[model samples]
Target: MAPKPKKKSSKFSGGKGRLSRESKPVKWIESMAVDMIVTLKKISSEYYHELPNRPDAHEARLFYKNIPTRRNRYGDIPCLDKTRVALIDARDGNDYIHANWVTMPNARCRYIMTQAPLPETTADFWSMVWQENVSLIVCLTKIFEQGKMKTLEYWPTSCGKQFHQKHGHVHIRNVGVRNEPHFALTLLEAVNEKSMERRKIQHYLYLDWPDHRVPICTHNFLQVVRYVDEEIANYKGKEPMTIVVHCSAGVGRSGTLVALQSLVGSVNEGQVPQVCQVVSMVRKQRAMAVQGPEQYLFLYWALTVHITSCCQIPLEAKKDLLKRLVLMKNCSTKSACSLSPITTDQPDAATSSARQARNEDGGDRKRRPSNVKRKTPRGSVTVRKSKP
Candidate 1:
């Protein structure tokens, strides 16, 4: 029979070998992960040939140095001399090239995503982390929570409360690996406190959507609707609310929201195509990755909520609208002509007569000539106009 494993103790610690360990946990994207184990193995063995001078170690550059796959080994990659930065090329080549070290500015977003539960914040949090200069923030989890003195006081704030009040309450959640600062664990153990640093209210309950209620005002149209009835009394701005959305990738959630916004814009303006075109323009700017196929189909339905509005393209009500438009256009054109002083002393009668003469000449020029054959260099005969 196989011998049972001995466990760790004061005298002898058997490490992982002693423990009856199981297989490794599945990773989200194993092919692209720059795991701690691999990163360690790499740094320990590689040569850090000194490059006299190079901020050259920025995230985009360093990312390519340590290749993960044996089949796709990379050499001739410029050596990284700088600290706190590595280059990570996103366009082509190995994906995990810049896994570990990276430029401080570029690393901030990427590093944050690597650690445990995604970081969440209130308005105070958003202000600090927002990088207007580089719009594409490396994907990272952002939490929004209200109330404080909770266990996860480790929960950092990026934006301040002022920015959040107008939008809605702040909340957070983790899909898996309930880390030490677990939501449920924090709620039960921590005391809600109000001190020199933290805010007053008890933390709002963590929201788990789909498992919970699908949010009613998840999209901007819903927000506008809420505003129309004075639901969002303090809401400012007639312009569309800027919404940030991501579901692993910004495509799905963002596309859905943009689609709904298009729907709302159309309904509000009573012009459906106008909104459809608007959504199309946005998708062009940022990929409809938000729409991928599934969400795209749904977005089609969502935006078409009031399709009848766009169906006929509003045929000028009683045709009187067209007439009025034509009359207005004619008047506007005449007014423009009238505004310009006559450059030459052409009498009105002369002008009318000149126009008549031009018209007569035009009619003569437009007359059909008799069909005739003409000799050509090639001795070819074909239909031809008689010599004028």
Candidate 2:
């Protein structure tokens, strides 16, 4: 009998049959979508619960002991000493403010995450901005939300109006204001009175994000992120500028925005979007980033929209996957909507190893809420509390 002939294997086959070149991309996208869905489930059920808590040793000693009057907006949310940005020429040698330097992959000291300035700290806030040469400021909260002061008015409200901080001799004048759909843009000129040096600053206030809850629409938030990037690229500063991002406590909303930006940068660089890893990295620098499960899931959904658009996935497929993910958000329990595992290509070994290492280090730890309410001062009315 003649020997049986061997069949040639196809590059686009998984031992089932050969796929056309066009079908290959479709299969790859489908596989990626499935992996993302699984990752989302893990985030909701396992990974989130296992995130590391803020180390106890990184206490804000300056805020508590030396400068007790610095007045942390949130008592529990400490500004770790390792990452805190100190003012170079602070008056009376008190250089502490509730801000931390947050770094992203391939970008060093890219963002200064900060709390909204109180009446007393406003001058120090402007001083930090001037010293850092910040060209862009992303404000995630309004001055008042739910009739409570979420953040103090840190900039001049009207064009030509000036806010002068005598401590650093920093003067900020509002040059222009423009309103958009979900955000407002204000152009401000910061002048150092001593040296007569001036710097143009763009302040972007996002108005739609509710306290403690994710934005209603992912597209709106994504647009805000892209707009900020566009403004950064247009900057003509003498050196690369660090972006200042703040909300009430500077952890929840600020962290979410930074995390999304980091993930978008990673995707743009042709790397897979690792939601858990990105959040972990941010929290290591600034604690309690991506505050709750909802915010964490929002990151994944936003990335889904971004990745599908970038890869040009079929509209119908994208719609179906997004619809399912959205439904998962409303489920009462994490596993209420069961997603069956798909037999497809696995992610590269490097990604798998990184995830495994993160899990091991996490070790069933739970994130602690840092926004605890402090006692109201004498003769002051009690304000309703909300998340930042």
Candidate 3:
């Protein structure tokens, strides 16, 4: 044997010994990050561009026939008739609301995606909530954003106050409230004046989300999803409770939240998360879901962060990947890239410490003030009458 060919070193082996998978973990994380970035770019540029626009006649006939006053907050957004949520008991016999039922394949729960209740459509909004037996409302937009009224103050602002929608025959009482730094949880009791029936509802108001952009903190966003899931798990209703999710126009932020929640659930169940497919499915149910390339990219970034933090990945590898992810998210666009020393709101203590270390290394030192407000005390219920 010609001096016996030197034994080839195994890629899986380290110097003089077999290496555990954890060895050189950054390499593995790097590969994963690269794959995610590539997938996001391909989907954003190709598949997202090719999505068919909903036709006017068949898909959105009612949307067009509805009076201009009742049309969507954004004039161009279409609500597909096939999946539109009709007001079953509209006193005026006009059953249109800019809302749709978004059901994901193999999902246990369904979502009612709707625009934030317009001042004119508040009664219709309450009608749908009562008819659909919706117990959880996830509000993604603030009442006002950039000096424009994004959503009407549909719910009672203080504890013990009731918002009575006489036209819809619904009375919603603010029973309790728990305010957090990023969101507020209000316990509401919805009563049907017609049937004298009462149902408990939870309203989650996410205040940090910007009007047209994704939330800067993925961890906080996920916390909202977790809270929603917990409420769903604890539900004791006889029928399946549909979740009501809304932003201003009920497409971008709402869609992102739905997609994120679905993917997170999929991952927790040991299934592979398909971001592009999930988003496409959501858009089919609700037109223009995940509105921009930034929001689309955010789904990938958020899912990656979830995996690195929650899964059984090596700790060192997870840290490395997260740092790289922050860079990727911050530099996803030319405008985003111009900002120096990007900081992300990470969940775990390790990640938080790492962020602190990075901040010490010449990052922006100014901290954002917490948006949490004191919760109003529960007191005597007072109903406010509004003109129909």
Candidate 4:
């Protein structure tokens, strides 16, 4: 006689559960109705743009869980002062950071950008740039991000549980995308003891997601971009700074970020074809490691949404944008790096005015309650701390 099947785990199995023991793609709730608000910010010369109004997605988009926020205005410093690809490897209790910068040519010649290496000196590099100001920071490594490779060995078509045990996944979603008890953590307060002025406004992107627990995963990666744009509005001078994009390997996601940046430049610099062309060039330099046709299709959809989101071009103007998209091709990365620093081009009339206002309102520093932190529970569980 066949052995009896083991009893299935509870649906609330410590904040995680399979849709069914039978095995299938995890069920997803479409358009779950999250309240996402949009607001305008002056980038220069009264040139205003619309963006999300929160640090991470709509207040309701947290998958019914609270996202982990910082305490005492510390912890990874968010995007405000970081110059481009500022690395953040805060695992369990261990904290680490690294950043890589590169320049893809536009009208700005001799641009101060170069390719970034994997896992460099985070303490020294990010610290130096964080203390200063930069127009934008780019992550060069994200150009050709091939997702983490697995052996070509055939699988027995068993359960994910067994598959998971064979491979070690450091980032596990439990209390909040990731949670593992550790003995110690290096306090951010102690590291950068002497705090400097934070730029306040910044941007970021997440690439590949080999691990299942990443709060910002493949389908939801766009949320990171949404949140960065939201937090930027409150920044002093409202001047948006460096944007860092990464994936498991930092290639595909980074490429997407660069491509978007190039598209935004089309609107900001008022140079249409040039900006689009530049983005195409970057892609050629780094092959997109996005899996099969579905992911590629997602790219097309994402690019359209991203461009319209930044430019706010009316639906009427989308026809021309669509035409441009059709003509665009892969970005070239051969000589993509190895270029001199380009001169910092000034913003146009409208953008410059907005920058001035941000400067006038800049100096004041704001910090949230030192003890409070946005909690993101694993699976769908939200922890409610007792009110003080």
Best by TM-score: 3
TM-score-wise, the better of 1 and 4 is 4
Model 1: lowest-lDDT 10 consecutive positions: 12-21
For model 1, what is the C-alpha lDDT against the true structure? Answer: 0.24
Residue lDDT tens for model 4, 139-253: 2222233463311111111111223111111211111111112100000111122443333212121233322122122223333333332223333433323343443333344
Clashing pairs in 3: none
Q: What is the lDDT of residue 221 in candidate 2?
A: 70
Q: What tens digits encode model 3's per-residue C-alpha lDDT throughout 157-208?
A: 5664434334358888665455556666665678888899987676778887
| Model 4: how far residue 386 lies from native, Å | 14
lDDT by residue for model 1 over 1-388, one digit each (tens)? 1111122111100010110112121111111133434532332222122111122335234434443332111232232222211223222343331111211110011111111111232222222122111111121112332432211233312122221231012232111111111111111111112221212111111222111112221222232222221211111324211222232233334334444443443333332233234444444333332333333333332222222112232333313222322322232122222211111112222122223422443531111111212235875433322233
Give TM-scores for every candidate, taking all chains together and pairing residue i with residue i: 0.27, 0.73, 0.76, 0.33
lDDT for model 2: 0.63
lDDT of 1 at 362: 54
User: Candidates 1 and 3: which is better by TM-score?
Assistant: 3
Minimal lDDT window, size 10, model 2: 364-373
> For model 2, what is the alpha-carbon lDDT of residue 319?
65
Ranking by TM-score: 3, 2, 4, 1
- Candidate 2: misplaced stretches above 4 Å? 1-40, 161-168, 328-388
Candidate 1, residue 113: CA error in Å? 16
Clashing residue pairs in candidate 2 are: none
